[model samples]
Target chain A: MFAFFLSSGLFLGWSLGANDASNVFGTAVGSRMVKFRTAAIVCSVFVILGAVISGSGASHTLGKLGSVNAIAGAFMVAFAAAMSVYLMTLARYPVSTSQAIVGAIIGWNLFTGSRIDTNSLTKIVLTWVACPILSAVFAMIIYKLVALYIKFMKIHMFKLDSMTRYGLFFAGALGSYSLGANNIANVMGVFVPVSPFSSISFYGLFTLTSAQQLFLIGSLAIAVGVFTYSKRVMLTVGTGIFQLSPVAAFVCVVAHSIVLLLFASQGLERFLISHNIPPIPLVPVSSSQAIVGAVIGIGLLKGGRGIQWKTVAGITSGWIVTPIIAALISFISLFFLQNVFQQKTYRPVGYLITIDAAQRIRDGGVSEEKFKGLQGREFPTAVKFSNALSEYTELTREERDLIVLSAQMDEMEITRSGITGLDTNWITPEQIAALELLEGRVFDHQWQLDEALAEVSPYWRFREDDDKYNRDLRQKLSYIYRFFRYG
Target chain B: MSKGILRKQIGIEKQIDEFLDLISESGLIFKAGIGAYLNGKTDDFLRKIEQITDAEHRGDSLRRTLEERLYIQTLIPESRGDVLELLENLDSLLDQFKGAIWQFEIERPEIGPEFHEDFKEVVKYAVESVESIILSSRAFFKNIAAVADHMHKVSYWETESDKVSSNLQRAIFRRKDLSMSHRLQLRDFARQVDNIADVAEDVADRLAIYVIKRSL
Candidate 1:
């Protein structure tokens, strides 16, 4: 059953590999500087390495946007995203899997009546615009420096050819790695909440989290896609688009890779935050758009005569059109999967404004008069609850979202089996001991469990001053919530 | 694998340099052959002919090897065609030098004392033009920016060769004592020597275009 649900995610992974690999190695293969065989091998190996190692950072933002929360729901969301990408490709429009998946998740949110985190949505949409522009700036700078070096040093033509060949190979490898690190979220992120795999320890040497395991499988599917289907796309990108010299191709690839790394590297984010600088949001960005922007950068540097503005406008339009199509497809497909197929597409979460919840909301700065009529009333979905709140109180979207979060009724039981199944290598011994003390206790909501655990042990409490530590704490807390709720 | 590629590249670079050396050396051999013929040193003239012919053969062999390696190894793919064409043109220039010397040996025309200075002057200018073109070809490989510097000088030497060859031909036709066939034969020798510089100028013009194509 797990494999049956995971097939859709794997299909999305395969499509991502088939299309996006060309963005990295297309110019090299098309120029005949690197063989297609060599490019495929290097690309597949590095992509897997990157996905397993650094894929978690971007998925966190996707989770914030909307967690799919059920296996059948994840399947339909991935299927819708993959189908939209295929349809757009068939229609000869520039498409991005990242945008498609975001739209599909939003569709799932609408169907489940879950509140879309506006903060996460705004951050993701802003990055979609910033990504290409950043790549263009990096390309222009690197191209100018390389041109100046060639002019002053005067390298022999053959030696320069050899150097460019090596440069293309390394840049392609880096680009492939960055592509996997940043874009794997679109493939397997929807399934992360309902992943059936548990963390496995290899004799205490290392541990593979369930999310990492999912990413590994998805990346392997991507590798298969690269080997089986990417050659044609690469050839077209290499020769059909603007004719770039090998050096210019190298510059474009390096610039694209840098942009992906900036958006995906957790280590870079940590380093920036530790030094009192604002961290860049980790978001999955479109690799094709980055390539187009890099190419345009070179054209603009050469006095901007060769750019086809019509094609650029067409591609930009596809960004808006592809997402709307994916969202509609996701909404319709999820409806059929739940009703016609008789699948449990989502678990209905009920919201009730209990006295304890009302007190929490009061602490959050909402007045008692705002919820006078809603006291002790139960709503089947978050949308229903928010509508009821709007009828009685004048509240902003953020305040309404906060009330919905406080009233969410997630019944969690700390059982012996759940306690024994915890990954000891991940959850510290002290955190586990705290969980053992609370064995057999019941909590009305996720935050109730969080509060109970924090009261028992400082290890579970979040540090307000440290963002990195708090992020890891939240991840562990989320894992615990799932383990106890569905174990 | 990289070491093997580097070794192959070094071998090709050396062969190209040797090929250019053969052309430059043949130009000197042509000049010496002309001087020996004018001074009536029969034995010396024959030796120079054998030497020029040997250089031309070696240049042909080296060019063939370089061309084969370039195609087989697929090195410098973007500029391979241009480099191969340049090599063939340089080889043709070497053949022109050998052909001119062979003409002198076959025809054995009786030369007057008055024509000696003009013949020597024409040969000097022709050799100078070939030498400048050789430098430009070297720059095309090693230092592309310096190619224009040497390339412009080829036209200058070709113009000087043109001046001397036209004066020598006019001087020969103006001689009333010489037979018409003999005068025409001497004129043919003058044109043959001057043709080497003309070919050098043409090769330089092609090289200039190749440089433009390669510039980023």
Candidate 2:
């Protein structure tokens, strides 16, 4: 049963990757600061570290669900949770895998007429309400602080670029770490109870160090999410909500992380309550929703004109339906399967699995199988591995006419010596595919001389006297030489 | 075929209209006149350039009393080579007007059977060029290019001022009583002044290019 919950945690980890990875570095990638690949690689390293170190608390919470009949029942619950979150992610709504998993186990517990912890459910629900509002308030304060610093320094040109780039890189790394630390348990905790032989503490001297090992799982899952369908979500977030400036993007991510960490720490929540400060609700709130709410705060400050209402409505509507659907599916699916399917389950012709691959080499030779009863997955349906390769360059015909844009990106990497981007790095395989796909295909040879001379400054920044008004000047000049004849 | 022909006709008519309007805006021409006179060639041209130097101070005050104000510039079209040509003419016009003050050029108009006749010759070219331009233009239109060819006659006369100076200097030297320093000073007076017509030729060339480029 404990092993069942662990598998469910792994599924949730995948969904978490899809939903929250975008929140970390989406702006930077969309703004062309960093490639999605580099961000994912960084995210993979740090998120795993974060999960190994900090994932245990959330994993333990998910594993504590008491309704499973055997280790397989635990796996069933985790599977239902994973499926629920992935479906929501595919629809482009970033539902919290944390919330979905929690809701799943709760609904699963109730359907079997097992003991449901109403107290825990209430605490989790309160977090759902408080997290977004707190994140927005924090972002507003951060924005005001950044604005004040700029006004005080009267900064411009070179100083602004150098300092902001370094600071943004550091922030991206930190955000990735915090996300991994906070989000990893959404995939790993349930396995703790079922695996007596594999039972290792998630924290401390364990190989993954508590929730941090979950980081690898979460990172891969989220990478798939980012690489596969993040373009629409990124567009909706970056260009739609207040047309994010770099400072605004930074503030949104920072505030979102602060809120995620608040919920992640029981010690912190307890400390806050012991004082006059309000307690953080125990439920796992989404890093995506927290970030979006903060973005909206920024947009509102910028004014209604910049906020695209249609997109916001679409995003908000998804958050509303995702968990309810997950819960219904888990309840109906888990309940019917446990009662009806258990009796008629086919017994496998047990086969021996390679033991060395499953164990470390020792003086005593290949160690005995760490745990047996390795059952094969069987259901009314087969699990299809849905890994997709992204074609970012070929996605647009006119924008793909950005043949020049891709060339410029490669040149920027060459001259700048590495990828420049903003936000947290999480390794999601999908992001890797997106990055690899962009290689060698970007228009490299057509305008090398042009990039060197006239376009010395980054296209992202506007500093020229007329650039503020001359939005079409680039297009005009490109074709002007063709038409401007003296003969 | 019909549409193509109409489009070509429309283009040409528009070009001509633009040419006419450019040459004949009298208000602008008047500003050009003062700019020309004040900025005329010499070390003292500083006095004229400063007159319109402050962009804010230019208005009817500078325009109405131009003859009194040596500060008044006749160099309109402030950013172009046309100013250089106009200023060359103004220098000769100033000398002609000054010689009229002495009444010597009218009495004897020959070289220095008049010392001032060279100046008179250059100013004649200037006056003729301006008059020809006015006759070929109405309101803000120009047919001045065809008549503009005749101004070269005055230009040739302006060029003749050089021979007048050389002859006069030879005569000064022939006279036994004249001091060497006084004769040297006489030689210097008419040297730079004779190049006014060349300046006018330059202005005409530049203006023609400007017109052509504008499809005028």
lDDT of 1 by residue, B39-70 (tens): 99999999999999999889998999999988
How far residue B205's Cα lies from its native spot in candidate 1, in Å, is 2.2
The alpha-carbon lDDT assigned to residue B113 of candidate 2 equals: 36
List of chain A TM-scores, every candidate: 0.87, 0.60
Clashing residue pairs, backbone N/CA/C < 3 A, model 1: none
Model 2 chain A worst lDDT window (10 residues): A381-390
Residue A5, model 1: Cα distance from true site in angstroms:
2.4
Misplaced by over 4 Å in model 2 are: A1-9, A56-69, A120-128, A196-232, A261-264, A269-285, A343-487, B1-216
Please report the candidate that would top DockQ against the real structure. 1
> Which digits, one per residue and each the tens of the lDDT, describe model 1 over residues A1-487?
7788789989888877877788899878867788899999999999998898888655443342236777788888888887877665544444577777878888888898976656656755665587778888988999999888987897767777777888898888888887788778768876776688899999999888888999999999999988987776676456544567788878888887777678766788889998989998776556777776777787688777666677667666766777777789889999999889999878888999888888888998988888878989999988899888888889986677768888998889999888887767678999999999999999888888998999999999998877778988888887777668842
lDDT of 2: 0.47
DockQ (CA atoms), all models: 0.55, 0.01
| Model 2 docking grade | incorrect
Against the reference, the lDDT scores of all candidates come to: 0.83, 0.47
